[model samples]
Target: MTATATEASPTDSYHGFLESLEEADEYAAIDTALGLIDAGVPAERVLLDLIAPAQVEVGERWARNEWSVAQEHAATHISERVVAAVAARAVPRPTRGRVVVACMDGEWHALPPRLVAEVLRLRGWQVTFLGASVPAAHLVSYLHRHDAHAVALACALPMRLPHAHRMIEACRRSDVPVVVGGRGFGHDGRWAHRLGVAWAPDAPAAADLVADERALRRVRPAELSQLADDEYASLAKRRGELIDGALADLRARAPGVREYTTAQLDSTVSDLGHIVDFLAAAVYVDDGSLFIDFVRWLIGILASRGVPASAVGLTLGYYVDELRDFPRAARFLGEASASAAAGTGPRAG
Candidate 1:
């Protein structure tokens, strides 16, 4: 049996960490984080240098449009689970105070808030994580019930901003300091200032803002608006590059792998490729027609290959891999054409 390839150190760990993440080796990243902890890396260091970097890559893959919603979701869940596990065993410090972490209404992505909870929990703060999409009323009621020193809100899409603003106001009226993070928050940081809340770009930064009264006092929501916009644009651009590079890189890396590897690789690649497509649609669909027509053509060909209709859903699951073999995909279209001689599934109309 072949020995598994291994990276030399944690500094070099991120590249392989990203590959393992790409390959969807969830536990591998977890185990690496644990190893870093065991190696006497501080919990904050583990989070800031190791786990945070990993999450950044995962987020970038999503932003670059390299991963589909499902791929991004899977990676997010894995990273969260891994971080939670590591955090569970984390050495706790004295309580800074209790804080509630939640996703604002209409905001389904929770990884940002979860990360904030973990970061604070590790810092010895009493953290209550309410997960994603909590209703505005419930969040406000919970804040009243717990009287938390602070509340942190996460929203990934700009569409969620209106809901986030409502939640922020609800918390503020109750005299609770609200901290808003995630992609959408930065888009309108100035608006957050008007609401009298704090805005953080990511969890680690949130931790600082939450624990230091002076730091929290120093934060101006108006200043935050530009910060959020800057952070959002930066993350969006970086994520796009990472994903674009990853799609090209992973596709180029696939044919050399084994069949079992190929199947999995193909699936992941397709998912990432689809993610890119989805983001492109999200970002630019209003501007002009995109690749829906091309995708329809490809989907029709794959449908004819004895690859079941249900498997078509898996196409989005493996977007990067599918795009890698444009020639092969075309050849398969020819095979699919010949195979059309035999009755199969529905063809593209």
Candidate 2:
């Protein structure tokens, strides 16, 4: 009476796989993926369909406050184990050139790029997956030492786009063509376009892009002339000062924050820094929507944790007044504040 992989819908397999992730049952998750492969499901499908979507849901669950950080970490660990297990079962010989895949500097979510690495391996490319948060200098040195045909980079957070750009430029300097992906580049990779690098929406596209040498190297010029304004640099230089000022403003405006526990205080500081970083990234790309979208997302994340949206509004107001001299940054802050007040910001998934 048991359903076979073919008999079971992809939806059923995904739900069962997600359940394994939820329970942190590494064995069950591995068995589920391996079972799909044994039942003639392509290994690529098992990776992109079963594992990829499940990992995304894990992130969404954490965002919605249904899962704690510990739970999410546990689930992610199990997923990584599952990926390793699946990869071990199907060792494909490389038939194509070497492609190096890595997370951008400061980008800690290695799983996404790992999946991409596995896919490239399956597609016959010898892929070296340099896991999370690789520094630019080290990555450049590695590329120089090894004969890398191309490099694929990942960034999961939009706030890291500026850093991602620097990393991409470093790879370019080493004469390695770069293909960038992940949510950090925006869902459609608009931010990657702004950085003037090649972009892929997912693993399959990346695999294809890396195979075509000419296409992989064909990148438009980076549209960062706005950096001439010096606002992003100025804001970045004052990041520490801005965070300290925001914390002081918060304590004065909301006395309850003054009594927060050490952990809460640490989280508050991180959030304050994220706001400034996202704002700076927006200015770097000259895109107001980047900052606006982050504001909406931050409001939702805070709300799920029982924090009020008005608190964010208050902080935005403070930033707007503080940065009035920086026309571009101040204008972006005003747009975010207005979006938050009008409740027009999209709901965070």
Candidate 3:
């Protein structure tokens, strides 16, 4: 039976919506959203308050190990459907200039930006949502062809900030103003400032920023003078070699790894690469806290999966030793390693 929103409180509706996602019931989730709309709830509210928070919870559940990756994907897909249902029920005619929304290169999380796109549409802007992992050149070409008034770029992971910087510059070169948001920019958008791009905390802010041409284009000059040292560049070039060395070090230190399954080995390699990528981003932005925060996040993630925090500490130690010649990279690693050892790493936002 289809659920109705006859007397459902906002809290009840949100919980039920999450329940539907947990069950992978697309119809039920859509019904919950539509029901809210029928109950005089604004479609935009349903999109932001209802669908958006539910997706965030879905990610938290996966992070906590309470939900598997497959479960998270299913929940995200259902949320996408709910967003579509709400949009379909209340399609607004675009009354403003065209806005292009896209994910940075290598950023695969499209749902957050999709919410921004729908909200922009609700507010009467012509929004073009280019989904996940859009390459820089292709995006620039699209912007040139469309004559967009502004572009909103998203980066979900801090490790992708280097690529995000490149893409932001690419858009600016074409004379299209850029506004970026997401956890990648730091919860407070500090990293966005480092990259020298305008930022919005969420969809509504993005909409407001997009509508104002001056604010969107009033970004400060990028503070990447630290890149002059060539540390970030050298670290990126040695990515594969670093991962290999870390793996060899891990195998020697942890004999249990020698008997691990293929999946376990693959995950280890990915983690090592993540450490290097995130370190390079920190070096690029000249921030040690970025790497420290990532270490905290990595510790929690690995802890939830039964890996010890000491494993991360070991890896950081290895990187510090190997990159000792690169002053910036070495300092960042040393600081993070100390934090990880002292259990003082700041929580990821």
Q: For each candidate, give its TM-score against the true structure.
A: 0.57, 0.97, 0.96
> For residues 1-349, what per-residue lDDT tens digits would candidate 2 score against the true structure?
3456557444568988898888888898998999888876778888899899999999989988999999999999998998898899999999888899999888899999999999999999888999999999999999999999999999999999889999999999999999999988988889999999999999999999998899988889999999997989999999999999999999999999999999999999999999999999999999988899999998888888898888888889989989999988999999999977865534542
Better of 1 and 3 by TM-score: 3
lDDT of each: 0.60, 0.90, 0.90
lDDT of 1 at 207: 88
lDDT tens per residue, model 1, 218-330? 55443223333242233334445645666555445544323446666676556445544433322221211123333343444445443433333333334334334333232
How far off is residue 169 in model 1, in Å? 1.2
lDDT of 3 by residue, 134-182 (tens): 9999999998899898899999999999999999999999998999999
Q: How much lDDT does candidate 2 score?
A: 0.90
Return the lDDT, model 2, position 280. Answer: 96
In model 3, pairs of residues that clash are: none
| Top candidate (lDDT) | 2
Error of 2 at 35 (Å): 0.6
What is every candidate's alpha-carbon RMSD to the true fold?
Answer: 15.0, 2.0, 2.7
Off by over 4 Å in 1: 1-10, 62-66, 187-191, 214-349
